[model samples]
Target: MTKSFRNLIWAVLLVTISCSDAPKGETKTASLPVYKDVPYLQDYSIKYNKQGDKLMLSQVFMDRNEVIQVASSEGILRTHDGQFLYPGVLLQDKTYRPLTDKNITAITIYKDQFVYLDDKAVLSNAWAGSLYLKHDLPKANVFAAGNDFEFLISDGPMLQYVSKNKKNWTGVLDKDKVKAIKFNKKNSTFWILGEKSIASFNPKGQTLKTVFQNGNFTSFALLHNKLILTTLDGYLEVDATTGKQIGEKKTKLPWTEITYVDVIDGHLWFGSTKGAFMLKKDGKFDYYYGKRWLPSNNVIHISKGTDGSILILTDAGLGQIVYEEMTLFDKAQYYEKQVRNRHIRLGFNATLVDMDNGNFDTGRLSDSDNDGLWTTMYLAGEVFRYAVTKSEDALQNCREAMDAMERLFSINPVPGFPSRSFERSGYKERLHDPERWQHSDDPEWDWKSTTSSDEAIGHIFAYGAMAELMDNDLKDRAIVLIDTLMSHIVRNDLYMVDFDGKPTTWGRWNPEYVNARPKMVGDRKINASNIIGMLQTAYHFTGKEKYKEKAFDLMDNHGYLDNLMWPMKDVAKAPDDADDWSKMLSESWNHSDDEMYFIGYWGLYKYAFNDTLKTKFKDAIIDHWEIERPEKEGAWNIMTALTGTQEFDLEEAAWYLREHPMDMVSWNIMNSHRKDVTFLEPNFREQTLSEVLPPDERPVQRHNANMFRLDRNYAKDGSEEFSAGDIWLLPYWMGRYLGVISAPEKNN
Candidate 1:
């Protein structure tokens, strides 16, 4: 450690430092995402102990195959071959002056130097074997820093800063309370994470306005201009400058008590006892834990490695994860396997099944009233798969699903009247009153008969798809069913009559019922649109004048055309009716109607019997879509694209595809507890999210639930294995079918 060698090394670094615009000591350059396509992960280990004895690895420095590791008790230089070369050796031998400080609390690779903290901080050069020890370092209660300055939080409930000029930290705030400190070099600002408030301070010793209040956070990391914090609740994203919360993120596995978060290669890597996980730039999570991906789930710390992999140091071992982005086909295939293997049943398949590896078969999947509706979506996925690849497996799946859907109508006594669901004679014997059941013309089967409009919508949707895409038997069966249903509706005054010989709760389309609502009610526009669509679809398949006649009568005489085409925003609440139904219909936008609007669009746009009506239908679709644009739903975007709407937001549609998780198992995802998400003041509709929606806000929701969810906590009952609404397959296949997305290049 001589001045001559110090000057020599500085001179040597001057050439390399001059190559970039960055200053001499500030050599840390940010990296782009390690992956640009779909991201996949692999893990390798660097265990703390080479043999049986455990080495508490606090930090590691890599130089090709040679590694210098700093453990709690000592430092070791080891080769990649599992050989410890510097056994019982020091960072500096007796030939040089050694650090006299005992109990080196920790060591880390910091900006342009290796920092070892004990009673003081030692700055060393791993290559030159030289060191600079600043013995003035305090046993700081709380400390953190940015590229230029180190901050300390003392019992004054005060703030202090240390710069290169002033080796001793001076008080930035003469007298004020502060809490935790984190500095981001990119913006040259220090963030205060505290018990009651979050505030910011600059290196110039100026305090900014408090960003947030009454907050609690356990850990946080910096991603470019944003700060990501994790608490016992969940993870959150925020802006450092404005203190505005961006959104909350949902992890695949719940992460709690996070000790650290590291932003590397444009991803957020987390360290916790639950495991180590990285929130990818694409919004998916890569969880690393257990023996397969790591030595243990008890992750303590994480650091960047030389090869762009993460250095995962646990209490027991060390590991590394190399990330790669896969092609879209790979992503689709993985989810396809999840559905085929776990989400299917012989008579009835739940939309989702248990994903717990330990008890996958115990209380797996969910029984749903919309089983027919949910099953058809999967069936439609297979139909598209068969159309694309002519796979026999896909054909069989489509056929099996059609059988379940067709059974809904036949199981009921009223011809062409589809029941909501059917079960074995006594499965629900005690739950429902005897009046709710209908025998299947046979003694063995009983079905629930008070079917809602949802079942009707689902039946026709699948029926139309099969008629247009499949073979003779399916097409004829679908056409015949359409004829029977249309005849029944026309005979019974435009309502879906239940087996009880009365209109079902939500199936009424009579003009008295549909036209009674105010012009502002979306329900008025929505009902007129749906009934007209059903009539048109019936005519398209059967070429029957009666169906076409009904469609025109509704449009011409009842003003159905005006009902369907009015702009959504212009709908006003008529003060005349304070009835609960009108109040509910007029008070807020109903995203539940969105599902009906979309499914009905298939017939409204693609199967309209007249070209003149089809053009009008196109205008209606565009009007509704324009207002829903902020939701960024893929199916709505892609389905509307089939009508040739200009600029259908294709990239955003693909983004939803790639970002939606493959694990459809309804894991518990709660966002109500996030400290970083903006919650709006209570309004009539009661909104929670202030600006934008985060990707993983809830786990395993259908497009219906996803678009409509206003609260962070799920309002529904008991957590199910599935959301019981498999929706990803529809948009994914629609993208493929519409050529908006193609299967990855054959080799890929």
Candidate 2:
């Protein structure tokens, strides 16, 4: 296929699945396509019934592969796959006999029985068990069931309760004011909705309580011992036993008109004129609309399918949402494109940029101190992606990214010292932070210097990854870049010397400085490991004995192994104080170092030439990972896979990608008041939640940011959402390179 054609196909795939970044409310200006909600089940049969035949189907239930039963709007019975025993046909194993009468009012199937009222005013029943019979309930207008007990109703709210055994019977609640009814099979109780109050009655006609006598409630569901009542405004949760309101959630207009609310398949499925929504048991609501995968938002009925799909019936047509359980590799393809098309920018001199809105003309972005760091991550992912697929686009993308990365080393005149980033001399925008930028001798461009250790790590990591994975000219370029950067570090007295002739704030790597820190300090251990890893990676790619010699000298002479392996639990924490920079650094774990450690591990584990060294280094990794395992982070877990670590939870890493939300557009997501999350108590340290939420479930967070942060509730003025490049591509391609996931076989 042509490149543009393939790109168009991928774009169609994404826009069809997830929502676009187009502005909401009155300001939509992208001319973006309306989101189409496509059924995950690509194969489906559409039946256009006979012109006179009733076309509306209300409820759907399956009998294995035998038949599919559907209820019509006229309250008649319909079956598609095979005949049923409704007209004396067995509800058990016998086939159904077609009904030509078309006089059936309504058919209700609850538990193991199917009940219907014929035109002759006969209430006939079909039971899956023995004992099929008929009862006389003239003008029976309603049918309900629970715990194998049948509830037959006529006018004036009169009711007949029959035991599961088809033996006993009684008139339970004959309230004239009854407006609605619901049966709770879980607790063997039935509820009655009235204008003034709601009542719950047991099978024995005993009153559970008048759960709500004070507030106006439209609908309700019995959740354990709690009554989840839907009021005019929002959801109201009350104590079922005491009839006292426990909680209330208020919302605006359209959602207030919820007509059908039933807990189906463990999710609360609700319908209104506005749209259809399935509220997760955990309280997260996944909304469905006509534009996005539905025939219409005017939901008439919501049900379940035999294969675990959601069956939706709207005003226009029936829609089935099949689970799009995509393979890990297919998802990777989508995300990789999401990054390239929207997030990445390649311009003058191959300078790559990440735009906040994933757009260029109107969106804003500025030079970052860690620009190379982010770009290298994207480059490494492509290297691994190309190694697995041999895709030409991935190679071309990497070449461009490397051009941007390589420019950093040559833009400044401080030997092999790389500037953070450089830009055209006079194009600084309104939001740009202007402290560190200065003009280069050429005067044509300005560069940001006083670079930290992060850029160097990113440079060496990407270059080494390319040397190991690429066979093209990129590998030669990568080796040259690594040699120049590694030489700069070694010759600068084991420090990343800055343009100002002083080590940048965080660029120190000299042994004397690392060893002088307190034993409990994280930097002491992290710095030793990063320098050793860099040295080891340099030796592996260039076959330099001096690089190897330095790695051994650091470990043997400075106790680097012991330092790297220091148990994290023994680390000191800082007390809350107004001003004390010395004590402040030790409080809580520095997650920034988590990013450095994982990046450093790429070299430590992948190029481990010494088996003894690899084993000890692996032991420290295991120690660090065990403390971090609670975070359930995909990137961290996938990076550890390089050690060939046994039982590295490869499946879990893939699960993270599958669960990550498709909406990459950044928003201010505030979850502090969410009823579902389990919040941790206040502490000086940052992790606000008791445990780390999955990427999609949590508020906005970058990869290196504290995974456990309780809030991104920060001012939304303009924060960039996650890009597919680093957040997604890293784990996905890593899985491909490690053989945890394989390319799918094309179907004939």
Q: Which candidate should be chosen as best, given lDDT against the real structure? A: 2
In model 1, which regions exceed 4 Å deviation?
Answer: 1-263, 266-300, 303-324, 347-349, 352-359, 428-437, 572-578, 673-687, 706-719, 723-725, 746-748
> Which lDDT values do the candidates have, in the order given?
0.60, 0.61
TM-score of each: 0.64, 0.64
- For model 1, how does the per-residue alpha-carbon lDDT over 1-748 read when each residue is reduced to its tens digit? 1111212221211011121432111113321111122223212233333333455544444433324444444543232332111112213212223643344555555553444555444444454744444544355334554554344343335555545544544443323345456666767787766654566766665545467553566666777777676665566678766777886554433356576677766667787766666665444455554432344566766767655546676665555443334555676666666567667754455654333321345445555667766776666666666666677876777777777777877888787787777766756542665656667777787777677666666667767777887765777877787787778888889888987688987888889888888788778888888888888889889898998888899988999999999887676565665566776677766666778888778778778877788788988888888877767787788777666554666656665665454434343444443333466665433345564443434445676654425333233222344522247777776556555555554322
lDDT of 2 by residue, 247-270 (tens): 556453225556556666545676
Model 2 clashing residue pairs (backbone): 36-293, 37-292, 37-293, 83-96, 84-95, 84-96, 85-89, 85-96, 574-587
Whole-model lDDT, model 1? 0.60
